[model samples]
Target: MDRIRPWLILVGVFLLQFFLSELLAIRYYRPDFVVIFILYFGLFFGSYYGVIAGFIIGIFIDMTPLASYFGLSPMTYSITGYLAGHLQDKYIRWSPFAFHAAWLCIISFHFLVFTYVRYQLLFEVDIVQYLLRWFLTMTYTLIFLLILQFFFPIKRIQGA
Candidate 1:
């Protein structure tokens, strides 16, 4: 049951995101709910689980024809998951500020790598517009992440 929950959430988010987008008439910015799940699982389960989740989810997204490049998402998301899982390490574990900082960096890195690699083979890259898009998308995603936490609080056992 514990093992299945996160994967179920990932699938739910993937399906929910489509309906939510069309229903909400969302435009301009979109949050990556998949990434949020990856982050959460990574943080909770540590690096091994994180890498596996990221790769599996990323591969699923690519198969949906969502990827601009065939393997970019798997590569990037796997890295993001690995980093997020690093938060579990005692030596550099979560302080409120450090957690947020790491979150920001991972998301930003995802967007940057995803965008750049995809667009590099296309037209000239517009740095300003790219940065603006990155900022907005990252901000919107974080907001969704906050809401997600309210509904799905991390389960903590007492006196482990």
Candidate 2:
């Protein structure tokens, strides 16, 4: 039971995210829930776990209908997760600011990467439209992060 808690939490988060994305029609342009989960997990766990979780979640995200390519999300999200994990160790291991910053950075990174990949590989779109969509995505991500923080509550490691 103890060992299952974390995995269950992760699954629940993923399901909730998928439901929200589907029901709210937030799929057009929204924050990546998998990335958000990975960031939070990395912040709470450590670099190794963060990297692993990131890879797993990246693969899942890529498999989803939201993703166009197989490797794009996994690659981008893996980097984001690894970086967030390392940053947590180096600076703000338990800081709420780290959570906020990491979430924002990953969200922004996803937007840019998705836009570039879609335009380069899939189809062309107007730069202004992309920028507008990116702004909306970031806004939604910020709101979600605020809500997640209340439940996840970043805690500082003692004597770290």
TM values, all candidates: 0.80, 0.75
| Top-scoring candidate (lDDT) | 1
In model 2, pairs of residues that clash are none
Backbone clashes (count) for model 1 = 0
Give the TM-score (vs. native) of candidate 2: 0.75
**For model 2, the run of ten residues with the poorest summed lDDT:** 151-160
Q: Over the full model, what C-alpha lDDT does candidate 1 score relative to the true structure?
A: 0.72
RMSD after CA superposition, every candidate: 3.3, 3.5
lDDT of 2 at 26: 64
